[model samples]
Target: MNKKLRKWFRGLTAGKAVHFLLALLWFGLTLFPLYFTVVSSLKLDNEIWDTMFQLPSIPQWENYFKAAETAGILSAIVNSVVISLGSVAIMIVCVMMSSYVIARRLIKRAKALNLYLLAALMIPLQGAIVPIVQMVGAVGGKNNFFVLMLIYVGLNISISSFILVGYIGGISREIDEAAAIDGCNLFQTIFRIIFPISMPGVATAAIVGFLNVYNELPIANVILTKTENRTISVALLAFQGDYQTSLSLIFASIVIVIIPILIFYLLCQEKVEHGLASGAIKG
Candidate 1:
């Protein structure tokens, strides 16, 4: 019995060792580009071409300063933050209300509405660019920040609502009944009771929506033609010239642009993961 137990323990240890090796390989592959970017961003323009992976002999921190000044990174950061947060707030409120109503079957055609929303998930945003651009122009929304915000909200609402619906369905209906018994109206019950319970789903939707809006390039590129109105992703174009691009400046700017989202994800990673798992299981 002791011999058998020892063999079992050995097998478990070997399995863990194999898993660790695989995880290390995956981590290296995932980290390589970011590491290369950071190292390249610090090299002098002349030095950058010397070795692909070698560490710079002398770090050129001035590349960041140049990138910031030339790219108008500060203004772009402000624009991205405002648009992303505003769109996320609008999306959450709209998605939560709509999802709750549908999940609870409060309306006669709730199923139909839910079906329609779910169907929209199959449509890619790329296909709608031309029509959206034309519509924005017809409505005189070109180069408008608020118009961009509205577009972000509209594009994200369907998926956010879909995620919330599944999670909201998993919540107890008795909670709504209880809220209603205590003199809560529809909006009150949803805001005070249901919304609080569905936070995991909300967190997931918020993160996803924020990332999409913040990193979105194509829509922002086409819609925001003015330099002053550009978001971070669109503003990166400043580093590119007709004949040549500034590699060091571009990479430095990329590092700056990536920091905020990386911090946000790190802070809320647990919530995001939990939300995704719960939504998937409930869905």
Candidate 2:
């Protein structure tokens, strides 16, 4: 046992030891917030701040029930899901088609068009929220989820385009030729062949677009003025008030809000990782 321990210690080179320590640190950092939230969510209001780092004496499962009831969590979750999935679906379709066109240089001045679309990246959409709100108001589109979905798609277009274009560009032209020779039309070729081959990129863009739309607050808050139409981010504001706040409830709500997205990320994590790695290499 002593000899084995000595061998194991000797095997830990400086670089390996440093890396292990860093990874351990990162793991702790990543879990700490979740631990804090879980503990705080179970405690009394005063206990949350006072014993923040400690576990609750008695776990208050009622906090979840209270949060769900008070915040309309189910409704908000449903709204977020509908809008997020709808927005990402639309975004993926638009981004993939546009990216393919750009990547294949199929359209006139495709590079110029790509650059023009990408220019939106430099302009912060949040900075122009006044005009956006005005434009939506002018159209009488407030509380309309379809309009919000469109806005989400528009906001995400630039980054999605960048990612998809790079990934699609990396795909070989020979595949297009093969599809053509096999009697596939442009639409068929793109959807059947290119789309599958470039799924990693699509997954990457979808994840990004979903996260953006789901967590969006200012626009959702303004547009979805009705309590019934509110998304999770907007609904969270119910817990916070000017004079007093329910910190425990807020943590409970947070835990509920994060569960779906965490599940989503876990499901798509493999594809997303591949997409990012390939995109980096391709770019």
Counted clashes in each candidate structure: 0, 0
lDDT tens digits by residue: candidate 2, 1-283: 9999899899999999999999999999999999998888898899998887988999999999999999999999999999999999999988888999998999899999889988989997679799999999999999999999999999999989888988999999999999999999998998999999999989999998899899999999999999999999999999999999999999999999999999999999998889977876785
**lDDT (10s digit) by residue, model 1, range 211-246:** 999999999999999899999999999989999989
Question: Deviation in angstroms for 182 in model 2?
Answer: 2.3
- In model 1, the runs with Cα more than 4 Å from the true position are 1-9, 13-21
Q: What is the lDDT of residue 213 in candidate 2?
A: 92
The true-structure Cα RMSD of candidate 1 reads: 3.3
Q: Per the 3 Å backbone cut-off, how many clashing residue pairs does candidate 1 have? A: 0
- Model 2, clash count? 0
lDDT of each: 0.91, 0.93
